[model samples]
Target: MPTPASLVSPRLPAQAAIAVPTSRIHALRTGARAAGLIAAGLGMLGLLGGWLHWPPLATLGAGSVPMEPNSALMSLLCGVSLIFALRSPQSARRSTCPLAFAALAVAALTLSQWASGVDFGLDGLLVQGGASPPPLTALAFIALSLGLIAMCKRGRIHTQLSEAAALAAASAALVGLLGLIFSVQSLGGETRSPPSAVALPSMLAVLALAAGMMSARPDGPVVSVLASSQPGAQFGRRLLGWLLCAPLLAALLQAGVQRGWVGGSSALALGVFIALAALAAAIVSSARRLNAAALHCELELGQLRQAAVVFRSSNEAIVITDAQANILTANRAYEDITGYPVDELAGQNPRLMKSGRHDTEFYRMIWRELHERGAWRGEVWNRRKNGEVYAVWQSISAIRDDDGSVTNYVSLLADITSIKEAEARLQHLAHHDPLTDMPNRLLFANTLERSLAHAKRHQHRLALLLVDLDRFKRVNDTLGHPAGDRLLQVMAERLHSKLRSGDTLARLGGDEFSVLVADAGSREEIAALAGKLVANAAQPVWLEGRSVDTSISVGIAIFPDDA
Candidate 1:
């Protein structure tokens, strides 16, 4: 759980927050969604057109006029949605309405159109030579309808909307054209006139929406003149977006002529569409292949997330700073251990946790090491969220970028309070006798060496005494070692309690012991402590079964003066 400060206050550093601004993201989303709706609408018309012509509907009912009214309505709705979509590129909610309309249009057009046309007893849905409108007239009408659409919304354009609308229109056109060609043979090559009625309306709807949407957007000479003057000019990336649908147009021509669905002028127009559609499909496919070839060139990201998750959940104290020695990021763990909210310390220095245990020079050394090596792994004294101080064993490292420059610093730390207690226990064990729980021979040796050095340097005197517990073996054999050990522990305690702060005592394993009296004025002072030790051991000690009395014999020597 994070502290209140961390939860309520600001988080995330200044640099990272600035890199991804909210405004730019919103603009891109609006633009992209508008573009997508346009694409989907065009696709609906093409597919619906292909079905209407290929399946061949001969006048089954009075309603079977020129073209399917439902498809035209769908194309109209798609155009309308696209116009509205100009405002929100990133939004899916607004785009769905148009998509639904286009879908409904396709469904109604397909079913109703299928029912309207009649199937011939022989050669694919063939119509007699003198049926209704000629095939060429229908094609020309579709083109005229699309041109009218372009005219209505030719007010103005900007690079963004122009690029978006243009791309959508071109793609939709190719799709609708291809679909019409594919369906031509099924509809009755010579008699069917549905394509003619549909072409003008569908194209008009598309062109009108593109013009309306583009005009409302901002414009520069580049976007306006380039698009308004040259419908086929290559400007910036506009050409690429337009080129995406080229293959669909070419496919339309192939279905109509190579397959022999239409004749003469219609065939030539179909051929042109076929050439364009083939190229578009090829380009989309080629782009995908090229991207696959350079997959490894992209840098691997997202690995940092796993480690960051672990750091957030951990219970140890943590501190995060930047390459500039200023703290930026911290985690929940830091809040839990320090009683500070993560946000309170964000963008601040690590002084928030200063325990004041070490001097400035000590910290300077640590900083120097970190800067020189790009990492420093060691222990440091840190203050809690409150004023208390604690010892922490920490590992700190530099976070770097691809260019090998340090960006931030991360620290992982653990508390070591129990470790300090263990050290004191080990020191006692080394100096004191285990049986007596008092200072031992090793401690006496260390004290003697120190005393000798001090006496040589400052003309000081020190005293030493060695003692042996008397009649302890008889008591041990009779009452067991437990009583003997208890007697030694009791005597060691008595002598230890009687000693001055400067004095020292040791148990030489079993019943033997020693004492040190430093800077002794005379022989009598040293002898006096030795005599007191022997008398203290003579006191009675109580055992479960019996009361035992123990005594010790003592010897004494004074440092420098005695030597």
Candidate 2:
């Protein structure tokens, strides 16, 4: 049987099932490892060159001096953490706690130096004259502290860690790169000036730490999200355009500074315009993605609402059940037809509707067919909540899962009680006289045949009487057929009252009837019944504001004697 399309369960949208791709995850891990190694190497080289006073590396130092011991120590801590993350992710995650503590200590020391101009004793051992910390050292420690705080969450790498690390690394790298480029430009035609002490190494260390933290865990939010096909991931990838544009913009600014073509106000305006444009692009992209997702959700919701409408408003009673036949849900028509409230019926078995009209075997057959073919359709007798037994045309089908295991069953029922009653009435009308409401001639013949066989088997006397109304046509012709019909109805009632319970009194035609007198003793007894029937017919019938007389002519036939 064909089931309604709306009856099936809804499925998840394809986009909703998307997950991060493996290839992208691999790329993230590789990038993080490479960045971490580069930062570790740069940190170690800068530390060693400064300590040993190596010429080639000393030229790259700030004011021709090596990095401060404390600043190099912080860089070494970040580099070591990144290296550990690259080697063992779980260990790296756990190592974030100590890293965060160390970063906080570094930030505190740097802040003290910035605020009080105090060397804190370490700068005196590392460099002569007890030089003060570079301006960028304070900012680098602040960025490191924030990145470590994000990374140290409950001793695990999380989405917050990745985002914070990325922002910290990007900001630190941009500041250092910009400052170094400006310093190099100033050296073009004049004496060379020293670069910031912490800028070069801090930038490399921050980038390594950020990349390492992002790829430290496969299940980390940033790596998983970036690897996925979600619109947000696509938008995030698009934001990488800023990373590419930053260097070009920095180069242009550096050139302008060198040529004295751009003032501070012009440069500030250029920066503001670029920032606003990027922000607008990001907002527009995010809005478009959100709109598409919202539209898809609305369409799915609309379909669900339409299906609910059809289920609630259907004329046929609908019931949904689990595989075990426990009622899960029912519609309004189910309540109307069964006279049971939905709340009362839920969780109950459908056997509550049993009317005792069908046996256990009948239900067994129904289930057998349902299991074999997944559907069964036929008429069933069920009881209403008011104790009224009624018939229904019911159809049942199984709802299966992808594995072909039955998950639920749906039943549709239409009340067929009126139709059944009408069918019985039609059968009766075909075999009985309409006017007198008695078995007609065709039915009388069949009764006579059965009576004859019974009498012959028992050696008893049987008699058949055909009673016809005399002057019946004259009465119809004068008083009308309605009066005639009324007279015939009265005669039938009178004759039926006089006959024995076992005897047959059938109206065979307009003015004729057949009576079967079984177990008669002799002809005299049969004649007496015939005379009585004639007397009953001769009585007056009151109809149509007048009394009309009707007479019947009786003819008798004996079973053996007539034969």
TM-score, one value per model? 0.45, 0.45
lDDT of 1 at 290: 50
Best by lDDT: 2
Instruction: Identify the runs in model 2 with alpha carbons over 4 angstroms from their true place.
Output: 1-306, 402-404, 450-461, 518-524, 543-549
Give per-residue CA lDDT, model 2, range 1-563, as digits (tens).
11233235423244333445566667777776676676556656656666776634533543343445556666666666655555554765677557656756775776676667555765555544333446455555566556655554433345566466566656666666666655643111223245434345555566566666666554555555666767777777667667646766866876786788997678768877986898789879878997898898799878777778788888889998878898777888889999998889877999999999999999999999999999999999999999999999999999986457787899999999999999989999988898888898888889889999999999888888888888888889988888877788888899898899999899877788888988876888888888888787777777778777778888888888998
Worst 10-residue stretch by lDDT in candidate 2?
A: 184-193
Which digits, one per residue and each the tens of the lDDT, describe model 1 over residues 157-258? Answer: 324434454445544544554445454322224334444223433443444444444443324233334333222222323554555445454555555666
How high a TM-score does candidate 2 get? 0.45
lDDT values for all models: 0.55, 0.71
TM-score, prediction 1: 0.45
